[model samples]
Target chain A: MNLIEILSYGFIQRALLAGTLIAVLCSVLGVFLVLRRLSLIGDGLAHVTFGSTAIALALQLYSAASLLVSLPVVLLASLGILKLTEKARLNGDAAIGIVSAVGISIGIMLASVGGGYNVDLLSYLFGNILSISYEEVIIAAGLFCVVMVLLWLFFHDLLAISFNEELARVSGVRTNLISAVLVMLTALSVVLAMKLVGIMLISSLLILPAVSALQLARSFRACIVLAALQGGCSVVAGIFVSFLTNLPTSAMIVMINLLFFCCSCGVRRLITIRNIG
Target chain B: MPVEIVATERLACGYREGYVLEDISFTVNAGDYVGIVGPNGSGKSTLVQALLGLVPISSGSARLFGSRCDNFSQWGRIGYLPQSLHLLNPIFPATVAETVALGLLSLKRFPRRLTRQDRETVETTLDVLGVYDIRSKLIGELSGGQQQRVLLARALVNDPELLILDEPTAALDPETRERFYHMIADVNRSRGVTVLLVTHDTGVIGQHASKMLYLDKRMLFYGGFDDFCHSPEMSSLFGEHSQHLMCHRH
Candidate 1:
């Protein structure tokens, strides 16, 4: 099919819009998470989403209804991760590891005991972005607004905590509350994004663009803008490229992000050499 | 009866590992320049953190501005510069101006957006600290001395009534360190900002501070520097020769 022919499909249009929106939220949040050394949080939460989705599937919840089960579970799981670090005195990675391990094991146990739901669960595991419904599109837009607006309102506080938690607390930034908000938002994003990038590849969407932007941006604002641009562009491009090449849409998006990251690294090296010269 | 800006009665604090501070009792009044001096592992940093409610008190009372430290909400009246400059991420991407602007955040409520007036305040603070010329430079790119000045400007930008610094000059050269002390003294003298400085530079801080608080996991001494010099307890603790050298240094 031609470019115009591919663009003509309603499902294709919905996929493109929702994918871009989800990608932007993940990328922007990823910047803060990466700086805080909580980048693995996306992956950890994605694993929890996987396990929760299995529960949802067993309960005969599918599509948007699945969110009814996964959303709250993942949100609580995110807080659990935070509490583990603070109260349990476990390091962030170790806490994430424990939560991630439990989540996946539960999912695996459900999948085996329940049997027959393998085909349905497989679609969620790998994603099926081209089949996105109109309601999912609207849900993606709402999620985008909610995350972005909260981020805007708490921008300086988030910046402060990400820079130095001790100093941010001294500034009366309400460090604990802000941290809870951050992780919960990440949980929400991870749950919504699983449809766009699949459970396994969701963390890549959160990490790659932010790391790429960090390589070259001179200011924090520029870093955020760069990460968002890369994220949105990767999604749009991946959709078209996958339609043309017959590759998996989610994998294509992640590959495009990797390509952008490589380009950023190269440009960074060139700028360094130019400055030296 | 000067107003009590900070009061801690028998305050103790610790981590899960063990207690770092104990039996710490002192009160700082308005406009007092108090130097908190201690040797390595002396819990000086922990004491300040406990006062700010960053570290939980194991027992005893810690209050700031008459409110319990745990309930103290008047952050706008206080500024703090922690000792962990090396702990800052090297590539944090915040400009000197942006970094200083964050100091004004303590004074703001929800939906805290910086106004044009706030920006001007940040600029004026940068100018006062002699960091105006490099306002646009990224913090990670600046030298240690420049970064220190930028951070100090951040601490002072809100025009806080009290400034708490923990080893604020650990990384500066001798000349820069001396200038930093004079600048702090100027703030205390001119603006009447209460000062609580933690440092190992007992001799230099003695020249600027009205009082001295010597700690070694406990309140070894808390009094006027003159009294500290004459106190038999300090003499026994430091040994007469070391005490004499510490007191006589200009």
Candidate 2:
């Protein structure tokens, strides 16, 4: 089939729909991750998921049923690390590094012990956008709805906690609950969106969109909205461009986000200078 | 009155260790202007934090409006403008309007998010501080003096009965600091808001504060400004060289 015909196929259409949903969700979360300076938490949790999938595969598991059974386990592990970081008052970058290294090592051990070299493992590591299935797409969509609803209901609380935790606590916000939920939301988002851009590039989609939105976004609410829009456009456009040139979708999406980040950085510098002048 | 506004007895205040300032007792009337002055490391800030429930009381009791300081849920009734209003990054995207609205987080008991009344109060406070023109401006873009005004407005937006300003004028130039002192006087006199101001500027306090609490590792004196300046303790605290700046208070 010709390139245009391939792109217009029903499977391609479904893939785009799913990718867009993932983009929307990741982008919304990316702003907070960047704002909270928890970009590495998302990256760390993605590594944790790798260990989870490795465990699932070593036991001969395939697909959603296995992911369902193991996701909680994976989430709990991330939560443990998050709690540890808070309790021990560790530097956030250090904590993410320790967790990432340990989890990836454990996953490598698991994969080697399984007596098989699976190419599917590599696919999940870096994403196989065209190879995304309908079931995972549905799961991603469901998760997107839940995350969005939670964000909506707790918008004020999230805003309070994100800006200043001590102030939020003094103002009677349940900062611990809200914070845990925020981290979990990041965990869930990384899982769903990692399928499109892989773990390494997922934060790019999340952080870049939010950074760009920061140029114009006044409030936390505006930041999230702008992030989602920037992410959605990047995904759709990236997918189209990648399709035309037969480039990797992950690389294309990340490149697009990087471009936006550079532009916003320049704009922010200009605005700051103008204000100073 | 029906409920005591603030009551503390033998209050020993500190962050987490033993104590910074020990054996303190005081009660403030609803509309009194109390200024705390001390040399560096005198536990002045720690004592204020204890009163604000941000620090642990190593011993004795601290209460706000008849409840323990920790349980004082009426956040709107007590406002605090910390020493460094610029503690937050300038790159942060909060505008003057939005920063002030944070004070409304305690206003969940009120019907609306931010009523027209709240907005007017904010504007009036900013105007009273003489920085109403910068209402739409990003807080990061403000001068140090302007930023303090914004922080002061945020503190007052909830219409608290008791305003606690910790060196609110510390970073301002002398003229700006003079203006802030005037604003504090206006808020206390016209609005009948009780004000507790903490500063190292003893001269300013002697001139303006109705009540002055002096400290050097401990409170050397606590009473009307007239009594504070005349005392030998005040003389000792200021030392012999500061003789001219501090005179017998009337």
Candidate 3:
């Protein structure tokens, strides 16, 4: 079908609207997470959502109602990750690993014991973005506004803490509160985004765009802007490409992000060579 | 009488394992340049961290500007440069000017937006530190000395009343280190800013500091430079020859 033909479908329209909003949210948050060395947090929280989704399905709550079960679980799991890093003196990766391992295992055990829910669970594992509902679109838009507004309100404070937590604290930025806000927002994003990108590939959405921006951007503000642009563009392009090629929409989005990252690296190298010669 | 900027009375602080600093008592008045000298792992950093409320105090009391250390909210009066410059990520995308502007954040309330006047303040501080030309350069791209100066400019941008530097010159070359010391001494002398500098370079810091606080987990010595030079206890602690080398250089 032609481009106009593809846009006519309601499912395609919902997918584009929801996917763009969530992609922007993940990409913007990814900049801070990458700088703070907590990039895996997206993946970790995605796994927690997996376990929580299993519980939700076992209870016969599907689609948007699953959020009623998954939201608080994933939020607490994010706080648990933070507490482990703080009190247990574990590095961020180790803390994430422990939480991620427990989450996936709990999901596996639930899927086995609960029985007859494997088909529904598989969709969450790999995602089906082209089938997004209108309610999920509104949910995505609401989450985008909440994350972006809080991010804008606390922009300088977030920048300060991401640069150096102790320095931020000394500057009276309330580092602990800012850090909690960041992770909790990520948890919210993860719960909302699992439907868009799936649990297995969610981290790529959170990491790839931000790393690409870091390669080419000169200032922090530029980095954030570049990441958001790449994220939103990738989702729209991936949706159109998936329609034309009959490929999976979620995986296509991730591949486009990787392509953008490679192009950014190439451009950065060319700039360095030009500066040198 | 001069106003007290910092005071610790029998202050004790430590981690989960054990106390690193105990029975530490001192009072720093306005414009006093106190050099905190000690051996490696002598809790020099801990003592300062305790006073700044970065670490919890186990017992006793520490105060800044007459308020309890933990409860002190007037961070605009204090500027601190931590010892771990190596902790800064090499790819951090902040410009020197942006980094210096962070120093003004303590004085701002929530939704802290940098005003045009804040930009001017950052510019003046950068010029004072001789880093104005590189204000637009990325912080990680600067050389070690330039990075140190940029961080120092960040510390001084707000024009704080009390400046606390923990081993600020640990990464500079001998010539660069000498220039940095002179720069800090100038800040103390010209601006009348109280300084609490932590360093292991006992000999070099003695020349600039008005008083010496020699610590080895506990207070080994605290007095005027002249008193520190002649004290029998310090002589015993450092040995006569070593004490003379540290004190006579002034």
How big is the positional error of residue A53 in model 1, measured in Å on the Cα after superposition?
Answer: 0.9
Give candidate 1 misplaced runs (Cα > 4 Å).
B15-18
TM-score between candidate 3 and the true structure: 0.97
lDDT per residue (tens digit) for residues B97-216 in model 2: 777777767766422255678777777777876778887777777888888888888778778888888878878899988888888888999998988898988777777778887766
Q: On residues A1-277, what C-alpha lDDT tens digit does candidate 3 reach at each position? A: 7889899999999999999999999999999999999999999999999999999999999998899999999999999999998999999999999999999998999999988998898799988898888888888898889889999999999999999988888898888889999999999999988998899999999999999999988888888999999999999999999888989989999999999999999999999999999
TM-score of each: 0.97, 0.89, 0.97
lDDT of 3 at A208: 99
Whole-model lDDT per candidate: 0.92, 0.76, 0.92
lDDT of 2 by residue, A148-206 (tens): 88887666667666666655555556667787878878778777776789866776777
Q: What range of 10 consecutive residues in model 2 chain B has the weakest lDDT sum?
A: B241-250
Q: Which candidate do you rate higher for lDDT, 2 or 3?
A: 3
